[model samples]
Target: MDQMMETKKHNTNKGQKLNVQPLRTQTDIETAKFFLSKNKMGKRDLLLFLFGINTGLRASDIVVRKVGEFRNTKKPYIVEEKTHKRRKLNLSNLAEQIDEYIADKSDDDWLFPSYKDRSKHLTVNGVYRMFEVLGKQMGRDDLGTHTMRKTFGYHYYKRTHDIATLMEIFNHSSQQITKRYIGITEDEIDNSLDHFSIGI
Candidate 1:
């Protein structure tokens, strides 16, 4: 799965998916705070999880978000780095955490700033490596930064059956490709059948 996402070559590009798989589970979200806190990092599980799972922005776009950009008194949407388009998405957990992180912060700046350098942006590869080590420590090796996108499309389509919405977010060409992106398969259908009885 790590091999699928080719290196992000262009610093200026947005939504250029390397097609790598996501390495997330509900546990990753649940225990993420405790882990980061132990490392003396401020906990933003909600932000990380929402960024990972909700918006289909690549990690490059995800990490650069400023707290002011999302939960400010001034805006409903922010400009995306890769696409440079005005992007808007719901803010259930995202808004809440952005509020918490920025409430006491001096600058109210970059949402996911680098550990060593607060003013500098955090790299996508950095977030990827952090989560990679976290996943390994937890004995869960099947996850990655892209896991959020995978889960977002998976659950969104699961609840709404709205492939078009996902297609637009992921910028895919078709619904079929979107389904594949979410990794839905016949096995999910086969397993679900045990709970339902089709009228014959």
Candidate 2:
């Protein structure tokens, strides 16, 4: 059986929830990028990976994007599918790459077109399956569509240590939820306990 199926079996036997975690380390992130660049849909997969980690957009929103939305725009506007909130994406970090990726494409083309039908966008489940293979290659079972968004949150928080800003970015109600969502709380707990002693 495949790693994904095996992971499901293991979770079922252990009666534990299957949690999708972020790529917490830079090395792991680089590894993911390397592997994604070698996938069958190398360029598209790499662009999607960069887009997700950079924008923190959900898989649904990212998949539905059109080349026109980002073309010649430094701050592309979008209304999130899940939140229905309109916001502008700061594409300064991705402008050069996006320009190159979309240079040959028309404005109406889906940013992440389906392999079978270029007219249609790739599905969220398709993104999940792609990440599943990436996770298996990375020796991790806890990775899915949310991993990209969470990876963005994790690294951003580590750099800025600004939970309030991250909460706003995620549209989360509380800082605690944002911390836990990005595994920050869990990481802190693990780090604190790693050096704890009871005078034994």
Candidate 3:
């Protein structure tokens, strides 16, 4: 039996809106993880979500990967399907999860294979639908596939506070673009205002 076919069933909401936004906060990310973890048939989807936020890979590149790509490696690399850029990621912590997720599967098996058809990997739209299902479950109607990438960028900037480095990572033309892309402008403004004083 296929890995996804052995798990319990899940029902999805209907007529969901397609407009989506980033996962945004750590709390929101955790909450989404919690919900996904509860679904018995969602192991693959859960891993896909984690890999997305951690590696910041676009859904296109992420959905096409095989389970064996992450074995026994501290630095797993991927070529961005959209920009054709090569990225090497430090994901040693993810090795255990990858190992567990792919235990019974062969090296050639898709990490996130389609539930209905194991012969083909899940499509980008399939990933979008996965996020959409989880988004509605978490009352985050704005959450979309890009949320994973934005979450990575947002938290990366928060931790490093290095826009130039982030700009390079994201391949943006300028710090201004990086700031806006990661929603840092408002954060900077709010942080500065919080430190403002008028001789109190």
lDDT per residue for candidate 2 within 25-142, as digits (tens), equals 8899899999999988889999999999999888888999999998879898999986899988998998998999999999999999998899999987788878878988998878
Candidate 1 clashes between residue pairs 3 or more apart in a chain or in different chains: 14-82, 22-146, 22-147, 23-143, 23-144
Arrange candidates, best TM-score first: 2, 3, 1
Work out the TM-score per prediction: 0.73, 0.90, 0.80
Worst 10 residues of 1 by lDDT: 2-11
**lDDT rank, highest first?**
2, 3, 1
True-structure Cα RMSD, model 3: 8.1
Error of 3 at 159 (Å): 0.7
lDDT of 1 by residue, 1-200 (tens): 21244234422333223444443356655675456555545465345655677666667678877766655643357676656777776766466656766787655677777878988767877766666666676666545566667777777777798889878887677777777767765346767887888785
lDDT of model 1 at position 40: 42
Cα miss at 195, model 2 (Å)?
1.4
Give the C-alpha lDDT of model 2.
Answer: 0.86
| lDDT values, one for every candidate | 0.63, 0.86, 0.73
- Superposed Cα deviation of residue 186, candidate 3 (Å): 3.6
1 or 2, greater by TM-score: 2
lDDT of 1 at 94: 61
lDDT of 3 at 40: 56
Off by over 4 Å in 3: 1-20, 189-200
